[model samples]
Target: MTATAPVTPDMLTIPRKDTGGGLPNLVGMTRDAMRDALIAAGTPEKQAKMRVGQIWQWIYHWGVRDFEQMTNLAKDYRAMLAETFVVAVPEVVTRQVSEDGTRKYLVRIAGGHEVEIVYIPETDRGTLCVSSQVGCTLTCSFCHTGTQKLVRNLTAAEIIGQVMVARDDLGEWPEPGTRTEADRTRLLSNIVLMGMGEPLYNFESVRDAMKIAMDPHGIQLSRRRITLSTSGVVPEIARTAEEIGCQLAISFHATTDEVRDKLVPINKRWPLADLLDALRSYPKVSNSERITFEYVMLDGVNDSDEDAHRLVKLIDGIPAKINLIPFNEWPGAPYKRSSNNRIRKFADIVHNAGYSSPVRRPRGEDIMAACGQLKSETERGRKSKAQIAAETGT
Candidate 1:
């Protein structure tokens, strides 16, 4: 699609060059779909389910990418399966690690498009931030990724492949036929779909990929551990709860429609009223399972005391928490992060009003891997020698 054309997630064309040609990649298929694929590939119908289970464990549980590693299967059957299907994930093009131990991966996918995923290492839990699209459609003014035009929605394989790629980097997968309960709390503990795109816009693939994540036989993360952040895709809010059932986070940068229109442009499509209405009824939200309101602290913009109070009133009955993110600046960003005192005051207002308001300490700022700072290299325009000289003076 051209840069200016309106992006429809469902209709976007995916580059088939990475689909392993005629051989299907089984990385992102749901259990039932994988079973169906196995049967279609000439596995006896009666044995398809068992084969899927065995392969699922080998691929996900053990992180084995080779057919030769499937030692439990009959030799010829393993050969047949290998010839019929392949397992794959996004290819990591580059890895950047910040001083704070945050790793940013620039991964190349189909059509040579790239996206960034981040691993934030924390004392208690390591969170892997995953991307759902090649580039983002939502033009949230403060976001660097939003500065890039829409490319295409990631396929289910691309979505879950992100998780697999991170796991491979961390060496978190178990040996074959072995799993330990303690491995659940290993370095890559949580997943936040807050990396590079509006996840709700890519609903089906995101849902299916998350299913593979939460599957008992595979990566096996708890639904509570996976959080999907959206910039208010109202129609799919409830569907996210119904299908994926993970934690929900809203990219809510403003309390009023007037200001929000200039910040998160999607608010123009689904305004605060409609978005809040949907959040109030999100089937999975509860006291223990609070929805996160990701409010980026933009100085002199949406960080006023009144805005925080208004935010509290706006989310009145909903089980929610306010995540106060300091704006992670990028080149040509128009706004500044709110001052520490300003953020503290905002957090106080929300906390006094009975919601958890945590100021998120910005991570990976040195590598530009912090919140709202992820954008793939493919999004940049080519530079002429004059432009390069002007930029670098070399």
Candidate 2:
């Protein structure tokens, strides 16, 4: 029997969020479509396989931002590929440098849609947190990006391009003299899908980008090094583990339904109990590779000692680590960051319960580069007339 058509819109439109533009070139197509395009361009089955391999390498591994830089391929073949395919990159509209060395890039998608990607440099490693969508569907109250409505899923090219841009800024590209395996691995040490948007919601594109990212001959990053964070998309959780096989982190900011439902709105759809059950059944998860539960402490909200004890009970048997994130406040945010004493007390409760709960240090709050603080910088200039009228009471 013929299958039903995929539930996708024909014209790719940018989401109507406060920031960003429409992304036409990024919408539609799958892995099969990409492969067919290569085959139709006079590439034999064997050579097509080889060519796809090379394209993935150039697109991912070396982080080549331009198609013309793919010098390994012949000139004619490059022209043919260029005519048919697009190696689209999000246009970097603005860059902000934090006092603490965190850099946030405001990338303009097609049609003026924009999203934020953050580069956090450490003494030993540099982590690039990339966004997978224009805006987020989940309205997690504490998260800045959650305030915007869902625009659309980011295409594979856009998702991978964030890393390429970071490599450009960091000067971390692999040189001809330093072409060893160790050298490449150390360049972009870690990738986290925690910047903006829900990754599981855009599963296919995220998965495809990750496949290229983790390919040994391509980006060459290990699956263990890449972590895909979800705001508890329960149904897609198992599939993510089985298909992508990467580290999983859940944006589990609360310990109970009462608090979680208010913070993470999707918690209403997939409640804490259901989310925990799904985590228990996650494929290939083990003690060594424990699932990460991210709990952002909000004052007078979910930062109580009782909440911590309940959190430990909720994941009693699961192999997990709790990341205690002190809430990073943004302008107009409805909540306040829990005090140091409250955060430490909450962590103490979880740690005493035989779980590894680490209090995550706030990294880039000064420049809006911390966890759950990413929003396009361009949004500051584009205030709607309605908003202006409301502000002035006109």
Candidate 3:
């Protein structure tokens, strides 16, 4: 799709890629899908379900990438699996470590299209920001990823494979048979779908991948530990809660529809009122399961005291936390980060309104891995200015 073409709301209505190519990579399939895959590969129907469990545990729980390492299966069966299927994730093209312990990976997938995955280490937990698409579909004015045109949505394998790739990097996997209940809280403890595309735009893949992420026999992350951030794709918001059941975060930068329309262009499709209405009835939102409102503090634009008060009033009844992100500026970004004092004032307004407002510290800025800075650094000149403007309307 060219950049300037107007995107239909349901344009990403097809499957991500040709999954039927070669041996299907078993990384992102649901248990039912995998069971069917095994049965189709000539496994006896009675043995398929049992075999699926075994292989699932091997790949996800133990991080085994090779069928040869699956010693429980017979040698013949192992050979069969190897010939008929491949366990694949995105390959890390380059890894950059920040001074503050964040690791950014440039991973190349099926078409040699690369996306960035970031792992940020904190005192209590380490969170990995995984991408859903090669480039974003939405043109959020302040985001660097919005500068690129949408290539294609990532397959389920490429989606969840991000976690596996990071696990490989952190050496977070356990010995095959030695995994325990405690392994769920490892260094790569939490996952945020805050990296690249509008995840809800690629709903099915994100849902299936997150289902695998929360599978007990695999990565085993708790539902609460996973947060899927969306750029306010209203219709899919409820579906996200039902299918994914992860924590929800909104890219809620501006308070009014007028400002939000310019900041997050998706707001034009699903305006702030509609987005807020969805949030108010979000399936599981509560005091504990509060939704996160990710507000990027752009200098002199959305950082005024009036904007802060308006934000609190806008999200009044929703059980929520305001994540005040100091805008992470890119080379051609139109906005600058708000002053520290302005950010503090904005935080104060929300905090006084009985919401938990935490100013998110800019992490991995040196590596361009901070919030809103995650576009594929690959494929720069491939997209012309007209194409980008067509896609993003910058």
Candidate 4:
């Protein structure tokens, strides 16, 4: 279950990021973990629970990082917390705001490594695309992040910290004692794990971080509001429902195993048959809570009349929605996007069957914040277009 196991040579240079240089980080810990840390730090057993509640509200609900800002706690107790722990999130290195109101954040983590998180604003919801790893291992030929090699998995704190950072940028935190009700409208309403890395690859951190996100007194997002998109990690599918119970999305671009293996290389290991079987039995799938099949439209690649027909047939008996994403081009990317008419034709075919197939409008492309365009700022232009074409067979 260790992330380092599969990443042998890739993990040679990577060390587990320090937890605040040896002091425990309070940002990503579970409530029980925090309680244990508090008691270990000399808090009386009875007072530890109340102390954890106070610190949790200060750190999460109020967006306060400094222990001194937690005015409710005794000054001496605050001093003990300050000396024993640090509340930290990824540092924002550069932020880009798209013309369409999408914000892309390039944040610096420990070891000077970097990752990107995007906040996309929509009419009814604002979706933040969160990354799980520093780079990626899937190497999906159409994806920009896949071009870069994997670095390491992010810690639980770093995972949830992405949300905290976005909230800080959007000023979403309420004043102390203001409210904890779910009635108020939020600027960042929904979260999608469709950012830089395959979320299922770093399963435990993602689960723990999502648990923090859905906690009632803290960030307080509902289970239905958060969606975890994976590239069809079959074994972890059930755990996502039984444990986190958030929405599930699959990066299902192709209709056949041949096409899928070339585009999403991981499909070779767990092909469409196995992936579909897992989706059919997924505990979260129902009429109201359908699993999302994210299909990127690559011109003459995955977008065609036959592909659309086969796609609907493949997902029968499963409560599913198809998200037809236009291939978001990046520099040196080997594939071209499907034409609008072609994409719409494919959507029409799927919609004709019982499922909802909507062609996703390309967002934040001008700023390179669109889907499949998320690579670390440090890991760009290492390969020529011809080299990429050779690798992708374009």
Q: What is the TM-score of each candidate against the true structure?
A: 0.91, 0.86, 0.92, 0.92
lDDT for residue 296 in candidate 3, whole number 0-100? 95
Model 2 residue 299 distance off true place after TM-score fit, in angstroms: 0.9
Q: Stretches of candidate 3 above 4 Å error?
A: 1-21, 179-185, 384-394
Which pairs of residues collide in candidate 1? none
lDDT for every model? 0.86, 0.77, 0.87, 0.87
lDDT of 1 by residue, 299-390 (tens): 99999999998998899999999999999988778899999999999999999999899999988888889999998776555435565344
Clash number for every model? 0, 7, 3, 0
* Model 2 lDDT per residue over 110-138, tens place: 66778988877776777889999887889
Report how far off residue 290 is in candidate 2 (Å).
0.5
Query: Mind giving the per-residue lDDT tens digits that candidate 3 earns over 168-252?
Result: 8788788877737663447888999998998998999999999999998788889999999998999999999898899999999
The pairs that clash in candidate 4 are none
* Candidate 2 collision pairs: 14-22, 20-112, 20-113, 20-114, 21-111, 21-112, 21-113
- Per the 3 Å backbone cut-off, how many clashing residue pairs does candidate 4 have? 0
